[model samples]
Target: MTDPNAPVTVTPADDMPASSAKAVQALALKHLYIAWVRFQRRPESMRSFIGYDLLYFPPPYAAKWAKPFGYIRQAASTIAAIRRHKPDVLWFQSPPTFFAHLLVAYRALGGRRLKVVADCHNMGLDPDVPGNFWMKIPGTIPALNSFDVVIAHNAAVGAKAAGLGVRSDRLLVLETRPAPLPVDETAGDPVPQVILVPCSYHDDEPIEMLMEVAARVPDATFKLTGNLARAQSKNYPARAPANVQFTGYLSAEAYTHLLTNCSLVIGLTTGEGIQLSGANEAVGAGRPMVLSDTQLLRSLFGDAALFAANETAPMAAAVQDALSRQGELRQASRTLKDKRERRWRLQAEACLERLVP
Candidate 1:
């Protein structure tokens, strides 16, 4: 219905419909301006048309042997980039880490006018976790308090933030949204695989539980993907489970192939963090999931996912249940996919309207 060569029309803030709020307009303008600045600095970064100018600061060191200064340098570069871009809202993907503190310092110095939003990806409640130590300390708690808004991925995380003395009103729960599943018409041969396990080197992830489950279900084949650390990959539990097969990290195309063909996805992590991105991707691809029953996980997936209590025998039982009821779970997975997509779109729209109006 439209001409391909015609210029795209964007309504001006003043001329926008009355339904749009002034706050939304201001927010949108701020983000657009920031996006423009980012484009000027590195044009390639603008490929994704998401409204906010997101600057992700990856952790500094992978191993204990690495010097701390290298991480500090990376943090400094991130801060410098933010300063140059001068975004209206500075959204930190996962705060309470060392790199996040660097960002906090940058915001404190001269970026006071910036509307800072700290997006908490993990539950910082447990004292044993590395980030929790900083979160618990008196000085560190107030440091995080400076942000205008604290965005929690799930209700459990929001509660944790509140317990840490974060203002209840400022804590917004924004769950992670799965990317649209790729359509593959080829329809590869079905392997009848019951479980998919995506593993990383992180200790918090319940890899041991997965191994236990794989051992328990002799008839089921477990496909493990994602890069494992040298030690983890080398010494992976091999003797007990002939059904377990490690395929390392798959390319997007290959991963999609597996997702399209797999019966169920499973993860057993102890940390109160919400389901990892892979879990959302699996659900989006219409794969039933058996995840840990942490507060964050329960909040995000609700009853849509089969949950195990405290990362042990119950987790294996949940996985078995998902495997047994694959048909119903598959239908539930599709419903969840639809619900999550709608929620994500609404949240994104709200965020965009707030920034761009």
Candidate 2:
């Protein structure tokens, strides 16, 4: 007889039917590759033992290029992995529109013991975005509800998901916090007059407005760096203003180097609820920041960074403000670094509690 208080073990049964092997294994499906790196850095409780799918599926970069059958092939392999390994829990990342349909169908209809989870990164993803036909299916919402849990980055984002008919009880908020700085507090002095603008350029970001702001502040060069900037290079309004430069997607070393050495960092966005990833990198590097004015950014940054309305004029003013008050902004960066050090681990722990069973 199985002891209720005893430990559980998964013994390989190769000779057993393939289906039966899954009955013994406890795994975590990592189809949402982007979430893997974040979760990997968390307390081991949130760590998953297994992973599947491409290791490099950054949004719009690969997903946008993938043909329908390509997605089908990707989903097929992931499903096969889950059915074979039969993970105790499967965690998916943002835009949760991928592979979830099949898994929900299988879990609802099949007697699989898997408990599925979808973690939303608040990259300003909306299931209702037009032309995203997959999200419109009648079954999609129901399928998402069928998952054991849906972890949102914040309450506002959770509300967005809930509006799509998902139960509030199924949606949990895991506040996103800044990552720890890569360098020590006493690293080399920052470069003078170089403002680094880090962006993923998710839809609705004011890239052109930033360029205009760059044009207005020709004295301080605005370095736009990321995949989004590179992807939109062909459509850039004009030869970038004399002071604006795009550095393409950066290597970690390059990104860290730039973030650590910049005079200021700019992370502008349109989502009122979304937290920008660049904000975390800025706080970690102890660099002053200029973020678009939004309740979410304001709460996270408090007095640590400058805020600007999405308008070109206000954004330009914010940059000029940061430039004028470099001393105060530098102090704010120190304060933010301290706060991030104190709060990030706690925040990460809390998020994991909701994420893992």
Candidate 3:
């Protein structure tokens, strides 16, 4: 197994045909991926899609007062890591879009020929921070436009970047599709179970609506995964149905087991033009899913997942529907996974051609 910390050096696959010489050449390009996120699926998945040396800087939890200091420490470490790696291409995630800006300035001032790519999440594009003037002034637009390429999750998001002055030619729409997860066939709940994976009590997640939906479906157990204390502080529903269980936070292995063995997974969000990571996890596990009804989701998922509005009644109904048709939905999910993987390959290859050429 390739070490995640080591510099990326592509070795031609044993089974790779000679005709794939161009692919081998592209994969051989040196790459270093940097991210300052606590958890993300895109960087992890990118390792398999395209080779990269992942320098993941998971910032330690800090109080609001100490957050700035935390960024300072992480920034120092990131600079050292990049200088040591000295890669041909530098790809990084943008939520604190400052990271992208920092790299752009670094490349300019240090006189390095490094090509920068910004993988902008939805929040990275539009920070949605209420009344934050900094987000509006000299925000993501300038930082994004500075990159050699900017990756968006979908065309809708790409359009947003284009509207904000990021050149269309530099934008690539690359969805995050996780690698297939190992299922624990022996692990399962005695009662019918539904797993709700939220992206940390974001405003888009309708926690109260889900709680009500759980109350409606008492026969099925509902397990919510995340930091429960954070959820509570965010004013998420304090009281839940007897069937509802807060799983605090789960380890990666435990989380995968829960998703793979669950009767259904529900990924609900009120945000427009944003894809839920939880839904991707459900797809990775080939588990049935009930996702929020939105054009972006419908277009991406097609018939693989059940759609429901964020309202309580519709969501409850969808959950019940998914539980009943678990087998059919599971098959559909597998089919969707195959289709998405093919699509991702074509897009990734096109991206590599540009980067490697």
Q: TM-score: which candidate is best?
A: 3
lDDT of 2 by residue, 25-65 (tens): 32222222223221122211122212222232223224555
lDDT of 1 by residue, 243-356 (tens): 887787565467667776787887656676545766776666777788877776776676478878754577767877877787777777778878886676455444444333
Q: RMSD per prediction, one decimal?
A: 7.4, 9.5, 3.3
In lDDT terms, how accurate is model 2?
Answer: 0.61
Candidate numbers, best lDDT first, in rank order: 3, 2, 1
Clash totals for all candidate models: 7, 1, 0
lDDT string, candidate 3, 1-357, tens digits: 333344443333522222345655667777888888655567766675466777767666546678788888888878888788887888888777788767767777864678787887887765442222334546567777777788888888778777777887788888886556754434433254655555467667788888899889888878888878767787553677788888877765677677778888888788778788888777777888899998989988866999999999999898888888877888888788888877776677666665655
For candidate 3, report its TM-score. 0.89
Model 1 pairs whose backbones collide: 24-357, 25-357, 26-357, 27-355, 27-356, 28-355, 28-356
Error of 3 at 265 (Å): 1.0
lDDT of model 1 at position 10: 29
Which candidate number has the best lDDT? 3
lDDT of each: 0.58, 0.61, 0.74
Q: What is the lDDT of candidate 1?
A: 0.58
| TM-score for candidate 2, residues paired by index | 0.73
